[model samples]
Target: MSSDLPALILGVLCGTGGTIGYVKTGSVPSLVAGLGVGALYTYSSQRIRNNLPYGIELALLASTVLAGSSVPRAIKTGKPLPQVLSVLAASGLIYYGVKFMQRE
Candidate 1:
């Protein structure tokens, strides 16, 4: 599988989660963050796939945003969704961070 596949999947999941949150609770913030971060992840995936610049950086940024937002919520609420998101986003951070460092 391609390395960017994970980021693409993460983007789709984030978008879907955001949409679901909006539909269920009318959370405009959730919708906006979801779609916005999803778009950023998607763009980063494309850049990585094409070997373009800043792909890893962008992915790292998106992951950091996701982790930053979700970790506190997970700690505060003990909710499964935030916990899962925190784990996924953290994984993305580690993965992309390593990729970024490995680049000469």
Candidate 2:
């Protein structure tokens, strides 16, 4: 789990950029970036389903990425919803991810 942290962060970055890009301009590249991360994450989580990979984690990850990606757009558009959501999702993911890492 620890070893995957970097990949998770990378996914977060790509997802964030893609989400915001798509939202701001409806660009295909951004949409692709966001969906690509989502697909990869889903595949990985499913592969490890024997460990009880609930859907919540995947949702949190996706939403968090969406929220994070929404930041730049929010800044330009002066919207606060995405940032607020990102904060909430960030808190939840931190707690959840920590608990998950501790599992035997």
Candidate 3:
């Protein structure tokens, strides 16, 4: 599976969010999840050379979790942007992940 630009960007977004969460909450779990999840999504690209096994699928799972989590907040806040972007990213990731699995 070729790691593409979109996934990388999403990973950065996740990592940045995690960093921010860490700064705000001072929680070890938040720190780990953010960086871990970010790397799972972002570092699977060309730079990693021998990327993590099942990286795309793992990234897809992460994006799905993001989408699932954002939906409730969007609904409660009546803000559609977060939900829309998360859903779109998850859908795209799912598509690529499926294609990668099929190719394998």
Best by TM-score: 1
On lDDT, who's better, 2 or 3?
Answer: 3
Provide the global lDDT of candidate 2 against the true structure. Answer: 0.57
lDDT of 2 by residue, 29-85 (tens): 767956676565554445344454553456446546655666566667776754654
Write the number of the candidate with greater TM-score, choosing between 2 and 3. Answer: 3
Candidate 1 deviant stretches above 4 angstroms: none
Model 1 scores worst on lDDT over the 10 consecutive residues at 95-104
Each candidate's TM vs. the true structure?
A: 0.96, 0.41, 0.58
- Model 1 per-residue lDDT at 29: 98
Q: For model 2, which pairs clash?
A: none
Worst 10 residues of 2 by lDDT: 1-10
Cα deviation of 54 in candidate 2 (Å)? 14
Q: Between candidates 1 and 3, name the one with more favorable TM-score.
A: 1
lDDT-sorted candidate list, best first = 1, 3, 2
User: Candidate 3, overall lDDT?
Assistant: 0.66
Q: Show model 2 residue runs off by greater than 4 Å.
A: 1-25, 52-78, 88-92
Error of 3 at 55 (Å): 1.9
TM-score of 1: 0.96
Measured by lDDT, the strongest candidate is 1
Worst 10 residues of 3 by lDDT: 43-52
